[model samples]
Target: MSWVTLNDMRTWLVAGALAFALIALFAPRIDLTRDAYDVLAVIDITTSMNTRDEASGAETVSRLRAAKTALREMLAKLPCGSHLGLGFFTERRTFLLFDPIEVCENFAAIDEAIAQLDWRMAWEGDSYVSRGLYSAIEVAKSLDADLIFITDGHELPPLPFSGLPPFDGKPGDVGGLIVGIGSRTPTPLLKYDEEGREIGTYAAQEVPQENRSGAPPPDASTRPGYHPKWAPFGNAVVDNSEHMAVVREAYLKQLASVTGLSYAYFGQREDLLEPLVAAAHARPLKVASDIRALPGSLALILLVFLYGLGAVAAGRALIRSSLNLPPPKGAK
Candidate 1:
């Protein structure tokens, strides 16, 4: 298991105390991003989000809650004047929930829209990821935004290869980052009959969720038998673990490779957020986390420890590269 060393914990404690103690020591400076406005952020409200991956630990929370929490945490760090809009998608078309709004814009409007999200209106698509992605961009065509797409790999829309918008300077520009939430192995999703019996599974083509939630990995026996009435199973997504896992994995890869975009996985990994947020255009990497400014003195100490870990990793990579480490015979 990954761990924070005792020294690491103590170091964090000391740093936290020291920072808090020093806040009054120095005069606070103005935050440039405070005047900034955010762009459109699209979120997935699909049902597969209910599952937790086997890869993430047994107690891992659902994707839906994580998405909400991340947004909540992000809002706290948003630039003061920054505006945020909302969009949602399913297997087919996309729904525009809110128009763009500056941070100073109506607060209740956005929250009410978000709070109004229910499973019924979320719809069922076959996974038109490209369509959903582009749709958000289409709405933001006129305005500059840091578009954020959140989903659990539920679907990939049919994107026309020739119609993709440009980033650096093309006609169509859909600027922003994509955040994918979920795991490679999702959970066993099901569409229960009124009696609550098993049905079929829902997943994108060639994408299967890996077992990561520590639940017993799904076996074929867990799947329902062939049924003519269950045709929707093929088209309608079941809330199985396997599908959601694949959805998250495929979503990241596609956003990275297909769209020339960057992304952060927001499922149960809060530490990862700070870096991505730090990478935002207006922000410097120096502000690692929005919650607080890490002391340079403390960072130097942490770097020393990280160097030791880095050295081990470098040595292993070098050995593997040089063939200095013997391989199991015929392992390749």
Candidate 2:
């Protein structure tokens, strides 16, 4: 889309204010909405998570393991009166690990689900970020607590999941924090064969097999360790910090878009969950006053969106000037 000039922007803003004033004069002040302490941890379980770190000799931990550790730790640290939940994506779709629970609450069911994690899902891997997110949003709506996204932060395109309600999750009453774990830079690992031998990872074309090996078996569903033919190889890896930040930013932005929640970046479990719990306790119940009104959230979102459009216009103009742009020419 083209950028709006300062003059045009000012005019648009004025027009908007006038239009809103006319509506507000006859209509009413737009009302906002929110909910109680709901938190959902959306984790990534894509196949690439099996790589070790170059910096720390964290050979015992892969990305998924690190995430699981953080998740369990966060669960144990959750304060009373707050909700804790887990959502994760593998093969491009999300599964509800531990649906939102509260401290001092019975977690047996959620714990059972957590224990059910294994090599392959009830179905094979498909890994889509958007699908995971949409599922998480649905689960979050069923909850009345602040939603927390515990993730590696990468979003894939939507992989259609069944039994999901119809809505993109905007104009909903869910809010919470996004705690990012692991680096954004990818940590691609060497593939292993079935015998856990370090066979090379899968390439576009199949490499050579053994000497007339008795008809080598079919391709694997899991990571290859010792594919009789391809030898193991490793690539120089970059730090994942940047990708981590980007994935989280994307996830949190999606969270805000779906549910108007302020995404906080806290480090440790205590650092993360405590602030959310505190915010929940102190959460202004002013939104309760708005529920009785008609289409409040929609109206307010429109107003906020209008402000965003103005800011975007100003930003584009600045960018154009930096690149040496002429005044936008048009007949007066």
Candidate 3:
């Protein structure tokens, strides 16, 4: 199929520039995007998040480290007067480390709080993701704050199809994001000592034997028909042992969908920022909304293009003048 000619490019550019200018000049007053709303950042401190699959160059980092680093950067970018709080999901429940406080005034405390997030805080090996999320929303509801739940979506002894946990809230009742962390490529989950020292990856067979909570790992005798169920079992034997640990994107997305929360991967800064802001429906403190920045940015870009074109034209004119000038004093 044939495409439009180069002439269309100029036409489109000119039209866009004019549109931006008009919008900038005639558009309603736009408010600044300094969203100063209370945001509760719930972090998953489970062992699965301790996976060491995230790597940058030669340096390797745990999923929890990546999360904390990203979160710290995001926290620093949060506007003044924006309230921030911290929570941890472990032992099958969500615990608020502290209540929501303004970022500007309590930054030191918040930063320290984030740094302290560790797998050692996990009271029970069990990670009841659905329950944890439900409890988190309930907590956020009391604070009247937006919720940002960060997790790898590792549910211990994975929930059964017949018993999906109930979400006890209306759609959008608590606006925020369910940020999934870690690589999509499943990697062996690293086991860590109580002192935060890594030992080794959990073997498939070992997964069935270890449960830090001291609760018995599910087997055919305990819960029957694949308690650590990953597949359907009829007469064939299904081993619940072998499974790679990674970011459960599909599960997280589905959970968020049912809970009326947005979902994003905690990889790029934008991935976390855009959905979070949208879900919160965060408004400028000084006004109801704002879009002037959009037009203003477009206008700036147009100016840049126009400036380049002028420079090119001026260069050509100078070249022509020099070329047309009589040979310097009839030499040559």
Candidate 4:
């Protein structure tokens, strides 16, 4: 009501603001339950992934490299409490390099591991993509983590006319996404030496032109040179575009359908994030949440309001002095 009382109240308000700010500065995070993800991602390191179908600035990059880049970006976007594991798919199997670990804590190690994935890691030259996807699902199941399988979807020793082998496991048991990596346009599949030196592109005859996994064509018995014992499929060079690598989107989609997984293409930097997050099932996790900022911001706003009030009071005092008005009752 009086100037003295108003001044005292203002001083108390300033002190209260400072106290709240100090508390905010020293406040510790509280434990809270929140939803987080646990993902085990397997990358296809087969030879077909060496195809340079993605562009980076003025340079073209291999599908594997582009996948790694997208993964690194995704790693940064994952929530702090979420977990991520890495693995390499080759030789009809997915080999788990490490179990799922907290993403934020082991970010550097996870990033370095992804960067080091190479086609030479394959022990065998065969790329059975369907089998590899199944293996990845098993690995994820063992760890109780969601699966993220990144591949160009190029199957070596092509699928037989009978189609992919039956998946024994129940579909949708382990949920996640199958990320297709590569362009639709066919590109020459690059060949490399054991030492990891790029030699040249594979010729059509160099790769399997037709499915060899099942019994030879039904008409094999009637063929001219068909030998049931030795050349059941007939030793003929089939002219097909098998050597050219492309993203088998349709095949990958079929695989996704059979496995109860979602499908996404790795094109732009942000392409993988949305599908990945959508595929992830939220698991409750205890997280240490820092709430100090809330009170700190409130304190800051209060201080600003107090400053405005002081400025108005000073302006009033100045105006009154210039007008030569007498001091108000109980004024200091």
Q: Model 1, residue 164: what's the lDDT?
A: 30
- lDDT, residue 80, candidate 2: 46
- As a whole number from 0 to 100, the lDDT of residue 319 in candidate 2 is 89
TM-score of 3: 0.67
TM-score of each: 0.52, 0.46, 0.67, 0.85
Clashing residue pairs for model 4? none
lDDT of 4 by residue, 1-332 (tens): 67766568677678778988998999999999977889998999999998998987788989999988888888888888899999999988999999999999999999999999887778998999999999999999999999999998999888897888899888999999999988889998898877888899999978989986667878888866679998887776776798999999999999999999999987755457678878878898897889999889888888988898899989999999999998788788
- lDDT digits (tens) for residues 82-200 of candidate 2: 56676666654567766666644745555555545443442433344445555666676776555555555443222122212234666545655555555544443336565556575
> To one decimal, what is the Cα RMSD in angstroms of model 1 from the true structure?
20.6
Give the per-residue lDDT of model 1 (tens digit) for 132-200. 666665666655665677776564332332333333334224545677776555455534344435466
Among these predictions, the greatest lDDT belongs to 4
Best by TM-score: 4
- Please give the CA lDDT of all the candidate structures: 0.55, 0.50, 0.77, 0.89
* lDDT rank order: 4, 3, 1, 2
Q: Between prediction 2 and prediction 4, which has the larger TM-score?
A: 4
What's the CA error at residue 256 for candidate 1, in Å?
2.7
